[model samples]
Target chain A: MTATAAPFRAKRVLPGFTLSLGTTLLYLVLIVLIPIAALILKGAEIGPAAFWAIVSSERAVAAFRITLTAAAIATAFNAAYGLLMAWVLVRHDFPGKRILDALMDVPFALPTAVAGLSLTALFSANGWFGQVLHPAGIPVVYTIWGIALAMAFTSIPFVVRTVQPVLEDLDPSLEQAAETLGATPWQVFTRVVFPAILPAWLAGCTTAFARSLGEFGAIVFIAGNLPFETEIAALLAYIRLEEYDYNGAAAIALVLLGFALVLLIVSNILQSWAARHREATR
Target chain B: MSAPDMIAPGSAATGHGRPARTMGARALIGLAVILTLLIVVAPLVYIFARAFSEGWQVYASNILDPAMLHAIWLTSLVAVIVVPLNIAFGIAAAWAVAKHRFPGRGVLVTMIEIPFSISPIIAGICYLLLYGRQGLLGPWLGEVDLQVMFALPGIVLVTMFVTAPFVAREVLPLMQAQGTAQEEAAVTLGASGWQVFRRVTLPNIRFALLYGAVLCTARAVGEFGGVSVVSGNIRGQTNTLPLHVELLFNDLNAVGAFAAASTLTVIALVALILKAVLEGRRG
Candidate 1:
């Protein structure tokens, strides 16, 4: 191969490359990078032993346990219900289907604090649903159930939105072929359709779980902030900050951030896997 | 086999085979609908119900109260400042990453998305650690007689961080999909940089940009966790609408709290409608 001198510079067709790119880099560093760096630095200042001590303390452990447990329950419920909701929206047509579809986004749009307030009001002993459930020995407010309920409410859209598009784009002939081969409806769904959407469904659930883990405003009002019981990790971090325990707050925040980063990476991988599988099938 | 020969006659005759709705399917749909109503719609309806429970006069008076009014203004101010800056950052980031191939592009995108995964409360703590009275920059700030924590700047900064990814996330994919052919062609026709962006790029991404703006506005107006940590919840000063609702509820003024919440509920409703409309148009 004859070696020719390479051009010293690449050609760019678009203008503002430097201006736009420079602004983007500068802004991202100033806004996102610096503060997070500050948090990591603050955590470093405490050293590993002290940081570990703070995060492993009884109160911190309890907060993490409660947060994870409530988020798990909420994600479990959403996984089933969100799938059903997406299935109904895609497969069946009804008079109010449009309205029902639109309403799925309410959680995303509504303020978390308002969601917390209204949920607490509705589940209080004197409130409507609470009037029914409270007398039956079900205490929702100030309980773990309340935390789970709030988590489920705020995260319902994630699962539905993720699954709905997949369902809509699903080819119906596969299911029809299953039926023609004498498979039952449930068999067609579980064997054929579910496999196609499984990755997306799992990704959605993981994201919803991750979101629930970090939820704060909605859970706070209903949680009653009872230490060692209903207090979530996010709330505990805030409390630590309020008490001016910078190291304590940083340690707890680091743990939550770690969980979030791991879950996000997992979700991203699942999403790409789903996309690749869909392409391969096509 | 030829394409036509490969297709079975019976399969072709089936058109798009939509399953006949069975009784079980109907029942399942019905159950799902009821669950959606119970879980999603009830709390929304309850906000309005409780707001007007003490009569329209009481609701009106509660909203008209000075502290609540101040809270509304503060919330608006925060949104007004935060949304524009976020929009600028989003467009810049999206432009740089989506339009240009560069090293560390993935890293930049991930950094922008970090706030989405991290808790807002944690973000607030980051700001507190950097700018609080006893923070790293606290002494410098104290020397300058500047208050960053528990004040307006802190509130705006945290909200901006929490809502940073909205516009960029929305617009980036669309820009990537559309590619740079149009912009390049316009530039070849002697269009300037700003002209290419304004005429060629802006129109393409206008809907997505608006959608992101609406989402950013909704979040900024309703943000609680981040603002709460930084605002110190000072009544009639630092309190935003959501914080004020919390303040009222803590004061055992349930009706007043609901009334304030209803205002935010209305804003959320408007944002939802706008989003739905934009989605419909895009679809």
Candidate 2:
């Protein structure tokens, strides 16, 4: 048995397995792992005291707080609106539905800088939306709201795309049976539909939140970058780099990285939970 | 699974009764439309409006400007270089992770996806810490007179980092779904491994590969934050189109900025259209 197992392990039907896998590992290490390791090593060299000092400063703390808050707000909006959008695209047939469905990816395809510029232009005091919104005393540009708006614009695709396929794949018979049993529309949705899509919706929201947390290009353009106000952790790291404060930049970046890592882990866990729930239901 | 039948048109007569459109559903659709328009469509329109606001002659001149032309060239150059390298890496990684059962398969998949979640700004910072003047190899690199930070190579590297996972992410699932049956069959029929892959696997995954490349091109062309951090914003030197747009805007060359921006916008739109077409074909 040991001899047979050894020979089987040595045999691979496809050639170049070692070459392909070796190149893959080497490339991943060179491109992804080493650079990330460099970041952690730099942070470590700075030590905990200096790292804490940099990240715990009022400005840094404020930046973190604002980034988190804006991301939370954006994710909340996406959670509701993204669900609606997915439902509409999946359940309702409307004119221009395909066009609208394609449009959902514009933010993903468009450069973040362009999104920021266009958003800032439209929301500034003299721009189109600005003229109306500012007159109504609802200033969006150069505010945290602007930051959140940009975040929402760029990250909304995450929620929409994630929830879309799940919604499309949902068994219509389940809803039909519920309705046939004398359930109201609200009851059918809340009892049958909502439960089926909740895990994906939650996963999508978490991913959107994660993405918003790290948003830099779009936010920096419209965020006004007022240290404790509109400035985000990412911008702060850029600022530190500009000031030639490597330690400070590394420390702040490490914090942002920490947040991203936590979010990614949470997102993964939620996704697996979603997959497992789907399997159980099946 | 007949699932598509349930969602397709004529579902009303398909035994599973389609829910009648209610007032709430109408309102929901309306709200979704409005939100999408406000959040997604309006800005896209705004870019073109501003681009053409200065008339065609100005737009024409901005596009023809040597600096703008250089920026466009650099952006293409980055995409040209980065996308193929990423395609190779993606193919390699996906081939290994999807086709083989390994002990650390899950970890490898997660690691490949790490860049997707990490901020581009942080990605730039990581490269900086690795290759900057005062970086880990800074002293050694100075001896060799090599410049990796604030240069074209740096910009390309960072753009590659940000767009790394696109093709892999697109191709992996499709390959996994297809399995290795066809390749195994080809091998048993005495076809070479390369021939099996080139003839069998490639045809099956070609659309996915193209879709991935299109997305990668869109991203590499539009990448801003990571490029910004590393490119040093050297006018007519390291500045890609996006950075050039930022520079023009900062210089208050609104016409030129929007003009350059419009070019990038067109690239994005075309990429999207291609993606949609490819997706339709795949479906």
Candidate 3:
């Protein structure tokens, strides 16, 4: 502790601790923290009763239900599609595989507004996909299904990207041993392969679900945005803000923020658990 | 371990020449290809198709419209300003969190990721609450006569928030895995902090940095919900490309909307190509 002995930081090898950490902290506080704090402070100013009143309104309730349900449907679809994609990309070899892999990232790279517009066009009565489905008496535009489709489109990559590496690293000998033990392919997957990828799969789904929950640009175009139906919580918040009801907007936003925070925490926990599980198996 | 692991997934008893297994593999691949075509490829093709629905002349006219040009310029302006600032933030955050251990290191990592979870629309609302006319800082901002909301600054700030994590997320894992040994060696050899980073660290993380920058640029240019909230949606002023597309669509100009959207679609394609190239190089 003596000055002559040098302080702990002084003896440390890496320099720029203060400089680097300071920059990080200053940016986070200015760009990230303060703005979020404004929202929280606004929520606080509204008080508990008023906030509850706004969030519990029937329209608000409907928006929440729709967002959650559509997100759930999107996540479910991604779970199956993503797993299959991951498995195929890692386990099979085929021509154009590389191109297909790159295609998987289109949702992430594409602008949400663009995605919404194209999806709306494709599903409209006169559009390509719509022309076929419309005659079959199945309409997609301005419905919850369309909302789910948009969510699915934007979040398609989350599960595939997360699970691909894990599947790639899976030990073949373990599957071989299961096969030698008189196990069918189904049993091998269920008993050995599925267990191994389960944690990563779940982590991916959680993130996909979170992404779907926050989706806005894409859904608005396709959802038809009818109140109490296709309108999502994010759009509802925007609507509140547009009408100059800051309190109402803040209330709905606070709830959405809470859900996001919870999901983020859950996803982080699941990811770490997956990492530890991988380490254990290795 | 590494060599076997690389071969294991592809070489495993996955297909085994069994008819049932071979059929299963083909079926799964077919399903994946078809689903991807429908879900991902269709919309992409549709963007271009609808963009040129009225022929290339109309598409060209839509893209060349003064309002469309302004939106493009504003979007580019935001991306130009936001990307460099975010890259710096990303480097500093990654350097701090990876090169050194601190009490709240984990918490800092989590905070950096806060934007990803929160809706971009919420981010816009947050800024509006902070800087809008009746916002928390509105009075003081008025006293100072500085406008944040409904201006370029608001658009840039919200875009920055939405994209802040991209570079750091890309660079951090690589930094952590590479360890601090090389940096420590550089320090012992009388190199300054900046020298060590520039000489030793920069080369190591350059690909990841580029990957992150590409992703950040795409996100910044395409950011809708947050920018929409703050930009005030003034035609030919605060409007971005995404917002312009929406405006055109709302005005019953679907062809113009798709034409505007097609430009973004090309950007997205370029980003995906760059990402794939970088991924291969990094590996």
Candidate 4:
């Protein structure tokens, strides 16, 4: 009995276990892990002193600042707008609802370059929105605002998609009971619903932020690419690469990659924590 | 507080704790609609508006230009090679991570998804640092007369990296939910592993696989930053459609760029429609 139990615990019942996992690991190594390892190695070769000198340079600092500010702005807008969109999609029925739902995924489907081109055109001085905005004491393209808008456009789906399912799956009975207990509509949402979706919302915002940090293709066209003003960290890294400044490129890239990896891990942790908390409540 | 008025059991269920009709509700709906129009639909409409602003003949000629044709061909070629390879990787990763209880399964799943978080530009930088002329394998690649960077192979490799997780992300959850019971039952009845997978698992996950494939195809066709890093933006040799759009725009050929962009926009619209349909089917 002991020998049988021990063997069962140690062994997998499924066939092709090794084959499938081996293939997965091999592909992951060749395509994903090895390249990342090379980047890290390149960063290491730059050494801590030179790396600091590169990353802390004035232009690098300004790029990081602009990227962070724009991403923060984008994430903040999505946090509010995304919750509203999710709430509308899940709780309400209206004409064009299906179209609206499908349009939420356009950012994911649209190429970033096209998105940038379209956005820049739309907000340029003589362009559609630009014609309106430029005279109204507002301008969008070729500024930090343009960068944020592009970031927002590209990352809107992250927040909405994350929160939509959680909102949909929320039990209506909880809200019903809260209403029966004399909670107002606002109170019911704040007390009962918001708590339920908060973790997922936070996770979504984190991913959106990380995505905005790394957003390049959609931003450059509209960003004006001014050193220390409009240039983002990712574009700055690309510029470094173009100039054959391998150390500069690798250093900047490592920081952006580090932010992405950390944000990703944080998002994953929040998501699993949300899952576990939901299970416990159930 | 009017709680008593709202206390009707069936009524409360229908409203989900809100009034059935309220000024606030209408306003919220209106706000959502307007913002969606401004944020999502306006740019989309702008693409075609500007694309054909110069008239139909110019638009047609832009799309038919030899360079534009090559860009289209190159983009499609990359997609053709990338989507199927990613589908294979996605399935293998899903099968392993969802079905098996390996010691490092969670880490492996994370590894597979690493590309999703990292920027495409960073991904290109990684590859460049590993394979460029002065990179780790640069000497070896040069010695072998193999050019992975600034060429088709480089484009494909980076695109593959970016789109790797889509199929797995879509399929893994469904496989996990379906569980090992049916497969074990098949095994008990003397079916081989391949037979069990084909007769039992594949049928269940086919829609999910297709969903992932659609998504993979869209990303493969649309990828820009990562591919740009490696492809070196050669005029007729390696310029993909997205890069070509950038080039035309920089050349002050706004109409041509938008005309080219309209084609990609059409692809995006079709992809969105397919995704919506697939989501319904999967559900």
Candidate 5:
């Protein structure tokens, strides 16, 4: 607003609302706001009772329960796996280390449909892992374990990625000092190393959780999608669309959007707290 | 460096038992190897095994078929159109948000990432709502005799929406880290905004752009949930490689579907390579 102070601040980047703000608004309108608003407005055509009835149906509830449960378990599993990966990638080197590091993004890069189909083949009754586990009575595909495994597969990178940079930035000198102290190894890890990485770990877990929650494709073929059983909320939404009920699908999707936003917000707080805790400890 | 380096009395030479460093290293390495093998290698081998199961004759037949070619071509067409547009969107948004911290920056950042959080199926629904015959814009579109839902236009738009954030998300952080110093230098020399981007900034962010493009291409090509709602699955017309795979799967052509899917797997593999190269360069 100040003309004299304008150049000093505007000179920093591409200043002036006319350029940066205008472009940012345009981008959001084109990509995010318009599409989402369209979804909501379209859903508004149906009455409130219809919306509620569709989203709260027994089938819908069952799908949500399974989706949330599987996603939670999957994300929790990934948190441990991801942390181990970040630690290994950052700290250790052995035969084929680079190749192993490269393997982390496999799930991210693989097509969801292919990933889904392959997972089904690998875990089906006659499949490789299934052949081994079937005798042991541990089923995978067409069951909850399959859903969790698929979700976990897709979300593997999120947690590892989040913790990786933070780990890379960590100084061994601090750990060395703690070691030189009379503090035991477990004490050093728990009191020092573990605490420092906790925030990033939580952030990564949140991302993995959110991604797992919304996953559809990778789980569809693998999950039998039986109502009140393995059916994920996303599959239920697709079924709604197939049945030509736009409102039903939108209501489920809106619920998903709400949950994602809430989780993201919670994770943001965790992320900031993690950073603040690190600084405070320092 | 401060108090830690001060060296507590007799601490360095203390015989207090420490963790076995080699033990930890070996343990971590073994775990990492096994996990990577289970998570990554095993699935790939399963899929690849199928490709060879039916012999090279069936593989060659599927790969060389006209229908398969068309589906592949359609996917390429979508990628060719979608990737660059998203790149433009990404670069513009990243430029605006990352270098310049404007009001509502948090809001803008969140807005950009909506596609990332929202279900792709929802992305498809969003398109259906926007351009479907009963949609808000339906009347306007009808006037021009433009049909989007279940058409090529709709497929491309949804792909754009789904992949909206890849390039922008990649570039923004890197740009923010780089600061605006170089671009400001270009501007001081009277480079126009476009010139600043083309000459100064573009070169620096090329790797990010490539990374984002690879991600965008993968998403666009493999897109099912979003595209399914808009495309009527018109085989040889609207059917993408992913759709073909699904359609073939539904038709009980397991071999056809898997064969079609293998092509996508190969594309995804390229995407994997691109990501690794870009990330390695970044690190």
Candidate 6:
């Protein structure tokens, strides 16, 4: 057959749009949108007072405070600690450097429950690290400190993973330029390098913060899950579900979802800023 | 560190910084390593401590217990299905987004990240609403004898939702970095589109695909919230190891929960090792 020339030809300017779009729609329809829509539909069944009373109870309020506060504290710790880890991994080399770098991913790979247990084992009164800290009068396990520890364990990798790539992309000459202009090392880091990666650092911190708020498997072992004390939001939801309180569970979940969505907005802004920085340097 | 074949040839020399001009850099690195050791290394040792506390006999018994074995088997089953299915989804999504400039490409990408951002428990509730006895699809599923929630299908579905983005996220970046040159070349050489994808595109993205699968499987195995919410956490039936840990914890078998958790952690350690080695190779 001879090739026919037409005034308008469908040249397929974008590669594989039809095929990819088909698959994406299928996946999202089956996996995400449908399920989430289900959740909204279910919540629509409950009365407003029932939703409020279950979620707003003193015990539930206490759980929310415990979970949200611990998550914030953990995220703040990672913001500082993860940046330091990222700085070391990105900027320095020593013996077993690769091993140390590998260690950063432990939080990502390790299950939360195991992380909690291991942390507990090390910090319990009878454990190795606990024995050292006992005389110093620091209690870790069976407390909010343990909850924070679990969150920190799971949250560390988020900040490190996010910040590591940004740091690697950061040009050092800018910092040198700052240093040569009479900035001290601390001043150079704070004023120059830190500012550049701050958005990404904030993005990572928010992700960690959101994750710790929802984290359950790891914290359960260490948190002691005491109502109005060590109990967290997710654990409260679990307890509500255990008591067959579906409305209560949904209300708490909706609250967590609200927080997660807010954090998402913040991270989205930070991500775009990161992208702009990359483009400018490129 | 000296694995010559894996890393880009001579990247060390190029990427390596000059020796620290000041002592501050030295101390900072030193301090970071110590903290990392304190945080990461010490706890991992304790996982071994909990597992091997009573030595070989105890470890053998704890590990060989039927419940632990079942948890491992169930987790494996979840991983087996979740990884392959997600890989397919990832490839499809990545291919579409990377290869196309659609009207909703940005929206679609954002949608893909919903799984990662939303709590898994919320995901479970989503399915419960859609397919539970009182769910929207409940009548339809009942008419057809299909059970979506409180079953294995529910577990698989939620896990899939949670991990759906991993491979696509990994492959999309690599594909974007490489652009469409090779595929175009393959088509020019009389290769069919399918042939081009299989022989050229597949090989190029294989490493990212595997990397994504590893991450996906690790997550699927560790999944608790989504699975727990949908699964009903039935012991010996619906209990994945994470669920089992919670069950034991509730039962006041703290040691048993720790033991079960160690099993998952050990798997995580192996996976983490594999991931690092693979990433090291890729870098």
lDDT (Cα, tens digit) per residue for candidate 6, span A1-282: 113422112444334555766888998998898877766655677767877887789998999889888888898889889888778777776666677767777787777667776787788888899999877899888889889989988878777767676677778898889878999888988888887887777778878887788787778778888898899888888777777676777778877877877877787887778768766663
Q: Work out the TM-score per prediction.
A: 0.95, 0.95, 0.95, 0.94, 0.90, 0.91
Residue-level error in angstroms, candidate 5, position A11: 4.8
Q: What clash count goes with each model?
A: 0, 0, 0, 0, 0, 1
Model 3 off-target regions past 4 Å? A1-7, B1-21
Report the TM-score of chain B alone for all candidates: 0.93, 0.92, 0.93, 0.92, 0.87, 0.89
Residue B49 of model 1, lDDT score: 94
Q: What DockQ, between 0 and 1, does each candidate earn?
A: 0.49, 0.51, 0.53, 0.50, 0.44, 0.44
Stretches of candidate 4 exceeding 4 Å from the true structure: A1-10, A280-282, B1-20
Alpha-carbon shift of residue B78 in model 3 (angstroms): 0.5
Output the worst ten-in-a-row residue range by lDDT, candidate 3 chain A: A1-10
Q: Give TM-score values for chain A, per-prediction.
A: 0.96, 0.96, 0.96, 0.94, 0.89, 0.90
Categorize the docking of model 3.
medium
lDDT tens readout by residue for model 1, B1-283:
0001000011111123235378987898789889989999999999999999989999999999999999989999999999999999889988888888766888888888888888888889888988998788999999999999889999999998888888888888889999999999998999999999999999999988998899899999999998999999988789999999999999999999999999999999999889777866654
Best candidate, DockQ: 3
- Between prediction 2 and prediction 3, which has the larger lDDT? 3
Task: List RMSD in Å for every model shown.
Answer: 6.1, 3.9, 3.9, 5.7, 6.3, 4.6
Candidate 6 residue pairs that clash:
A112-A218
Q: Which lDDT value does model 3 have at A228?
A: 94
Q: After best superposition, candidate 1 residue B92: deviation in angstroms?
A: 1.2
Clash pairs (backbone) in predicted model 5: none
The local lDDT score (0 to 100) that residue B139 gets in candidate 2 is 86
Q: At residue B200, what lDDT does model 3 achieve?
A: 98
RMSD of 1: 6.1
Stretches of candidate 5 above 4 Å error? A1-24, A43-47, A182-184, A278-282, B1-21
- Give the runs in model 6 whose Cα sits over 4 Å from its true position: A1-9, A13-17, A47-50, A134-136, B1-16, B20-22, B139-144, B249-259
Error of 3 at A112 (Å): 0.4
Model 5 lDDT tens row, B129-185: 788887778899999999888888998988888888777777877788888888888
